[model samples]
Target: MNFQNRKQLIVQTVDERGSVDVRELAELLQTSEMTVRRDLVQLAASGLLYRTRGGAMKVSLATDQFRFANKTAVNADRKDYICQLAAQDVQEGDILFMDCGSTVFRLCPFIRNKRITVITNSLPVVAELMSSDVTVNLVGGEVDKERQAVHGLMAEEHIARYRANRAFIGVDGISLQHGLSANSEKEASTATAMARQTEKVYLLCDSSKLETDKYLYFAPLSLFDVLITDTEAKPDVVAAYRKAGIRLIN
Candidate 1:
């Protein structure tokens, strides 16, 4: 492979495995170990990855959040279905707050032409809605580059500035006991802020997230006004949220 193709190959490897060793790249690209080292060095210098003892670890984006490329591929069809279900609640002229998550990103296309004002800190959501007539307000703060979402004290402060009719949030996990959790502390903070500013909070999660717990806890099940999930959600999990007075939609 040529130099350019070799570099692209290196990136594709990291995207697939989340990390790659120099020796593996050497074998795969039919290049010398020193040449692979050079490629790794170049990629690391360009902010593509971080070199470790024998390999490179995909640079953990924004400290704790996974890269968008990593997340955009998982449970895509389920996310699309949940988004379509959630969009049914959104009517024209509504002022809503959409939180960051892959599922919420899928809701963007269905939102076109809706006379709504969307306040969000998710860069992907903002980018998807940029050309639409919907008034989009991006709560600015420290950008979590890997997740491409904004969060921190500044983001929370901005979220407090507006009251929304509905807030659509997603979580890494939810359980009968733990409620909702997030993979990153910043995301938990941002989700909490979004939940607080809205009259009603709807947790949009896929079936895979049901009964799952991650690194950070966000809120109790009672906090969410509704839970929108895919049909694959476990019946017991659905019952748990329902028992907490959280309406369930599949």
Candidate 2:
């Protein structure tokens, strides 16, 4: 397998087994132990795993919340691709609502040229578009240090005052049964509020989030008008989503 595929496999194996030994990974991958060690180091550096003396362990899901910096590193390529597609939905003079989700934050750089107004709660989005031509209006509220975004009743009230032509958001998990969910209630509330004020709701997520449900359910599947994801999304899930009348961009 290629480097990207091999690294993905390593992450999947570690996630499924909770931990993996170097020798076992090397044998399973049909590669040398040196290569396995290198892959483990790379994944560890990305905050996807904890590197050990002779193996690697998956990061503890219970304690490891989705911090902005860490989320940016995970599925970096896929997020970029999804952002590329979502950027096409933007137009000149459009008023957009951007949620604080990591995947939705990727849209900032791609949208710099568009003469649009951005209402956002994300610190990273504000910083990225501050010097660009796009106008940024930050929602006021208490900042969540780990999330690097604004949240709370103040932020939700701020969102309610404005209506946008389109809103781009992200979620920690999405499933047919559980709908859209997030690990933090604050983030979930902010995302839901943004969606409520927009005419069109576009969800920017990677395939990993498909068929998964997190701690809090914020919105239903019908809240989203379009789902922008990478080609890696599961075929069955994509078909099911399409059947449910949600537009899919893969």
Candidate 3:
């Protein structure tokens, strides 16, 4: 596997088991202990994990908190479905604002062949689209190692200078009370900036996120033009979103 894919697996393993020994990871990855240690170092630097003497441990954050790689592994099938649905709206020449959320990252492969411009803060998104035909403009700012995205005032300022036809974002929580929220203020700010600069905003998430609330509330239900989710979403919750004038695609 490529380094990024391998790093993702390492993050998943650590997340699942809570902690992982370097030797064990090396065995599981079929690579050298040195390489495993190197991976752990990079992941730790990004705030994804805590490196120990001989292994790594998952960071203890709030309940809704998760590293980007770990987030990618959760609800894999649902996220893939949502991403596929969201990709249907992409036009060849569209300029897009892709958020740093894991769900948004899934949209990368589906839209790779289309000739489009993507402005994003997600590191994985940039890596995923680097070799594809899509034009990628990476926003610069403070890097959130755990989220594998850029954030902070500089990033938001850079995003403001450009506009997009569509914006695909991910949220930690979505509820009638809070509207939309994220685990950190930085992420919320970045998403908000993207939403403001786009003509249409698509919130890509799984059904579980509905009715949930997280650390930072960013936008209201009215900010999103559409929500793409898996079919397992609760009927009442789905209805509520539609009633609020946000399009729902299950």
Candidate 2 positional error at 81, Å = 0.3
Question: By the TM-score metric, which is better: model 1 or model 2?
Answer: 2
CA deviation > 4 Å runs, candidate 2: 1-64
Q: Which stretches of candidate 3 lie over 4 Å from their true place?
A: 1-65
Question: Which ten contiguous residues of candidate 2 have the minimum total lDDT?
Answer: 61-70
C-alpha RMSD values across all candidates? 9.5, 7.3, 11.4
Worst 10 residues of 1 by lDDT: 61-70
Model 1 ranges with Cα > 4 A deviation = 1-65
Q: Could you give candidate 1's per-residue lDDT for residues 1-250 as a string of tens digits? A: 7889998999887765554557667868999999989888998899888876556666763233377755655667888899899899998889999888877878899887798999999999998899998899999899888788889999999999999999988887787777788767887888888888889988888876676666677788876888889997767768877777778999
lDDT of prediction 3: 0.86
Better structure of 2 and 3 per TM-score: 2
What is the TM-score of each predicted model, taking all chains together? 0.73, 0.78, 0.74
Backbone clashes under 3 angstroms, per model: 0, 0, 2
Model 1, 153: alpha-carbon shift in Å?
A: 0.9
**Model 1: how far residue 203 lies from native, Å:** 0.4
| Cα lDDT of model 3 by residue, 1-250, tens digit | 5679878999898776555567668868999988998888898899988886567767862233457776786678888999999999999999999989988999988999999999999999999999999999999998988778999999999999999999999997788877898767887888899999999999998876777666677788888888899998878888987887778999
Error of 2 at 219 (Å): 1.7
- Candidates' lDDT values, in order? 0.81, 0.85, 0.86
What TM-score would candidate 1 get against the native? 0.73
